[model samples]
Target: MYELKTKENDSSVIEFIENVDSPKKREDAYKLLDIFTETTGCQAKMWGPSIIGFGSYHYKYESGHEGDAPLVGFSPRKAKISLYFATGDTKREELLKDFGKHTTGKACVYINKVADIDVDVLKALIHQSVAFLRETYPNQ
Candidate 1:
């Protein structure tokens, strides 16, 4: 079993974001970080080397896989901002239908720019995702 690091290294998070060369990208990242942390009630942390993660949960699968991960998080990548959460093909499908200007992977949603999406809708999605995760992984 691997031990999970609990508290965030705020300096790392700030330094990493600050080092982003693009002013626009850096601005966008900080903005998203504020929103994500505010919305999730989770302290923002620098995950690994680049991800800005929020609220964490511990999970142990029947197959023996176990770890701690942010209940919800995002990565402000070069071209887009990636939101992480679990998904069902149709779950939150309606929300996605209404979520503005973005792309989706299996469980990650990508927003090209904050100006392109509805912030309220994004919050709703985060709430829904967190709720779903809580229900799905009750023990966590």
Candidate 2:
């Protein structure tokens, strides 16, 4: 009996972006909104308080843990922008080679700004993530 902390909510994605402490970060958040929206063909939704997510899927692990998560998302954080994509996609590492300047964590790609990355590669990452999630968890 576990509950997911980052469930999708009816929060305003724009309001969240508008409140980003840094004006530059706020601007980049808008740019990312457009990129993720057009690339994923999905409207942006607020996941939790800060994450601007596009599209979603429900996944259940073999250990019986299950939750719904966005196919792709990003957050304009105080330190750096966090990009969320499918975790197990084999192409993830390959795509990161052309993703421009960024660092990777288990589930997020961290970038200093949109200018630091190739927009084309970002779009490809978004598409790949959505497709991977759809294939990995079709029923949800």
lDDT of 2 by residue, 17-131 (tens): 9899999999999999999998988899999988999988988899989889999999999999999999888998899999999999888999999998999999889888888
Local distance difference test values of all predictions, in order: 0.79, 0.92
TM-score of 2: 0.98
Error of 2 at 134 (Å): 0.5
Error of 2 at 10 (Å): 0.5
Cα TM-score per model = 0.85, 0.98
For model 1, how does the per-residue alpha-carbon lDDT over 22-88 read when each residue is reduced to its tens digit? 7888888888888888998888887666677887777677998777777777877887888887676
Candidate 2: residue 66 Cα off by (Å): 0.3
Best model per TM-score: 2
**Looking at candidate 2, what is the lDDT of residue 21?**
94
